[model samples]
Target chain A: MNILYTKNISKSYGDFWALKDINIEVPKQSIFGLLGPNGAGKTTLIRIITQIIFADTGKVHFDGREINEEDVRKMGYLPEERGLYKKMKVGEHLIYLARLKGLSRNDALTKIKYWLNKFQITDWTDKKIEDLSKGMQQKIQFIATIIHDPSLIILDEPFSGFDPINVNIIKDEILKLKNKGATIIFSTHRMESVEELCDHIALINKSNVILYGSKQDIKQNHRSNTYTVDYIGEFRNTNGQFQITDQSETEEGYIRSNIRITNDQSPNELLSILIDEVEVHAFQEKIPTMNDIFISKVNEGTNA
Target chain B: MHNIFLIIQREYITRVRKKSFLIMSIVGPLLIASLWVVPIWLSTRETDQKTIEILDDSGFFKDEFIETSSLKFEYIQTDLVEAKTEVLSSENYGLLYIPRINLDEPEGITFFSGKNPSIEVIQDLEWAMKSVVEDIKLERSSIDQATLDSLKADIDIDMINMTESGEKAGSAGVATIIGYISALMIYFFIFVYGIQILRGVIEEKSSRIVEVIVSSVKPFHLMMGKILGVGAVGLTQYIIWLVLSIMITTGISSYFNIDRKDSLPVQTEQSGVIEEEQENEFVAEMFNSLESIDFSLLAFAFLLYFIGAYLLYGSLFAAIGSAVDNDADAQQFQLPVTIPLIFSLIVLTAILREPDGNLAFWLSMIPLFSPVIMMMRIPFGVPYWEIGLSLTLLIAGFVFTTWIASRIYRIGILMHGSKVNYRILGKWLFMKN
Candidate 1:
């Protein structure tokens, strides 16, 4: 089921459209990547979903119902412009934010202790946010965002200030949250992470959604019908049926060529033809990475 | 409602626990107590007697200077040069030379002191010289000295306020002091605590925590929570100061018996019995002057105006805070908010001068200035209808400002990095989103 979706949502600042005719669906128990370049209204769409801002011309639904104030209690948002009260104690700040999301004092305290231990930050509970390093503060901010056990979590650039190890830790946590049936909307400029994590994604550019779908489907739709073949042969080209984009001979006397076939050819047909000509060691279709798709689609948008 | 309360709790607890708040609460009363007690104590303290060397080159002025407990006159038969040398060599506190001159003119008298003489010494010297010169003039004109001496009585004016009902003694001096002080205190708290609301909002915005909190609670709630929280803190500090100052003032005042000698002037060469009688009457008048004010009504009006004025200004301050990116940016908006506060303060002197004048009446009726201007006018017996109207307007002002502020607040807190001019803020106020 679609846990959250925006129907024709649009937002504008004076004459500048921050988000325009944006529609997205976040499936339940899925890690949905919200991919966009800078100034692409990714943050604006996330804000609208979290209700930090109201969409100028559409409706946002949570669990197939129109979003309301109570939906905020069930939703969590970690904004890209992160902040905590620098003068406030780490534990107090967390508990306060937790209680604000409708947890009782005791519940907030108990949850705070659990998260502190999970982050290995129990010792830093009494320290102020200013005293913590940037990575540690980001961890605390993450805990603050999700401390109330929100079912729908939205993180905007959550990995910005984290170290590689801490990034893995947070990625593990995001996966763990998905396993526990939480719907997550992850927004970032890091396309490689999106390729590894997102089951679905929507690419937005210039306040408009240029591409969106399940990860596999989007890659397939943008596929160029190209394949790389690794074979040992005294090579001869196929005459006008397939196009060799690149050819290189390995040091072990093996020839590797990237070939794109015409519309009439299939991978199996090329594989059978290659087998008859040379001993084919390996052959695979080259699926485009999210990084390539994001760049190409964004460039396509800017050009158009 | 609950979220607003929680926010208030957070704001209040953090501020009240600050070391600066504790220090100010304790040190403020001590400062106020010292301000009132020190001058009274200094006047009553005993000082070493100082003798003045007087050379009467005008022989007619011999034995003219009187000896008081703190100052002594020692007549010397010496030339002016010798007297000056003696004074320089510490023979006396200073030298007073009455040079040879016609009593009618008396132009050549000189007082030489190493440092600036105290005001008391100067006044005494002038008094003695004037009395002596006048007596001599009267004697030369063939008037009886005894009659002139008896006619040297001081004139006292007992001012009365004549109402339609009867004549009642006026307490202008005491009323002015009370009125001016209360007006200034209201102005001070509103300015101080109003900025606190501004700074608190700026802190939340600059730190970027506003979005996090805004997600949980409406921005209106957050603004109201902060404004009320800071106002409560201000009220707490004010009450503590009030109670402490009163305790310290009364404690020190009675211990020093400051009321007695400070109120009565020293009567020169009067009979002991008559001086004692006049001192008692003066102390009685002081008590009567204090009792003339309606303390309960003054306190009630003071608190009502204090809260009204603070809430009104506090909301505007919060709006300015949300509109700006930082404290420096707040300066552009601050001037407009503070103009009314400062204007009321500038008009305070005029209110004290004429509490019943049309300027005071109209200014006191204005909601922005009423908190202070009306406070000053209250001590001078303002009409009840004016006070009621002023309060009604103040309440309406607070409500209207809160509405306007919250409208801006709802949008401004989430906005980042935009240069916010007054026009932008005006648009935000009316913006539906």
Candidate 2:
């Protein structure tokens, strides 16, 4: 079932249209990644759902009800720019933010202590926010966002200012939330991260979705009829059903050449000719990487 | 709501815990105390001896004066021309040339000093000349010594205010001075610390922390909580100062039994000088009488006005804070809110000298000005209608400002990098979607 859905969502500020007619649906228990470059209306769409900002002409629904205060209580949001009151004690500020997210004081305190201990920041509880490192502040913000046990989490650039280890740590946490039946929508420019974590993604370019699918399916769909074959034979038949796209000589009197299969020919048929002509070493289909796909699709969208 | 409490708690704790607040709390009362204490100390404290050689040309009196508390007067019988040279040659202050008293022209006493005489020297000369004039007058009138002595006694001017309603009659004394000092202390501090709250909100808004917090709480709750929390911190600091100042004042007063019985009165009528009609207007009398206020009424009105005015102005300040993206943007809005506060203060002290005046009624009825003016007026007697009307306006004004502030708060806090002005704020308020 679709948990969050928006159809033809549009917002404007004076003459500038912030978000054009856009449609998206985050399905239940799915890690939905909203991927876009900066200023691609990703934040505007997130804000529309979060209700911090309103859409001039649109409708949004969470769990079949119109977006409202009650829906906000069930969702968690971690904004890109992290902030904590610098003068406040770390523990106090964490508990305060948690309670503001709709937890009772007792519940907030219990969760805050658990998170602090879990993050190994228990000794730093009395330290002021200004004294904490950026990663530590990010950790505190992450704890506060999830303390209320939200069912749907929206994180914007959650891994921006973190070391590799901390990034992985946050990635694990996001996965854990998704494991427990939480629908996650994370926006980021890190395409590699989308491949590693996102179960489903919708690529938005210039306020329009350019591509939408699972990571594997998207990579598969973007794959050209290209294959690499390693054979101990002379590089001949440059003009044939299978034409050499790249050729590089290998050791042991072999040629490593990449070929593009003709539309009518199967990979097996092309391989049989190479098998009859020479001793085959290796044959592999060249699938496109998400990086190549992202670059190519963004360029294609621009051209269109 | 729970959200407002959270906001208030955050603001109160943060502001009160600041080192600046603590330092100011300890230092402010001491600064105020010095205003009164330093003057008295300077006047009564004894100084080193100074002998003055006054070369009086005209035959005024016999030569040598007795030593009184390290001061002695000496006279010489030199002619005006020789006295000027001798007085300049000697280390004396100057030569006073008093021509014969014609009784038709004001005598111009020439003080021929190379340098200007200090205020002490000027005062000494005036006193000595007064004694000479009195002696001459007594001798010419054939008055007895006892009558001359009685006539030379110092007389004070006392102003008494009488109400037509026969409610009470009074004059300024130590209590009145103390009350005015206390009321002014409250006024200045409230003005200072209340702006601190506005500044604090502006800082948070500019720094953009307000974005993360307001997402979960209503803007109204946040604004209300912040204003209340900061106000509470100010009150805490003030209460501590109040307690410490009273203790110190009481301790010092009892320690030395510092009774200022010789304090300059409301008016000192110089016996020989004529009075001007314009100067005798009863307005100064009314104000001087008000300086000594009824302790109960004065204290009550002060507390009420301080709190009511603070809330009224503070709410608007919070609104201004949320309506602008930065301090630069906030400036466009500050003058409108602050002008009424300043005007009320001026009108209260300057224009509305009489509580029964029509200007006072108009100023006291406006909610923004009422808090400040009513406090000043209540020290004088205010009619029940004036107080009731002012309080009603103050409360109503607070409600209206809160509503308007909320509108701006909700709209402006989320916008970034945009210059918010009357045009946009006006448009935002009218926006329904």
Q: Number of the top candidate by lDDT?
A: 1
Candidate 1 lDDT over A157-239, as tens digits, reads: 89999999999999999999989989899999898899899999998999998898999999989888989999998546557
For model 1, what is the alpha-carbon lDDT of residue B408?
Answer: 92
lDDT (tens digit, per residue) of candidate 1 on B262-298: 6345554424465567778667666676666667879
In model 2, how large is the Cα lDDT of residue B266?
A: 22
A303: Cα error in model 1, Å:
2.6
Assess the local accuracy of residue B265 in candidate 2 as a C-alpha lDDT between 0 and 100.
21
User: Candidate 2, which segments miss by more than 4 Å at Cα?
Assistant: A1-3, A7-9, A20-23, A56-59, A63-68, A208-210, A224-264, A269-283, B47-118, B134-167, B170-191, B260-301, B323-336, B343-361, B431-433
TM-score for each model: 0.89, 0.79
Candidate 1 chain A weakest ten by summed lDDT? A233-242
Model 2 TM-score (B-chain only): 0.75
Q: Give the local distance difference test score of model 1.
A: 0.86
Locate the minimum summed-lDDT window of 10 residues in model 2 chain A: A234-243
Computed on C-alphas against the true complex, the DockQ of each candidate is 0.68, 0.41
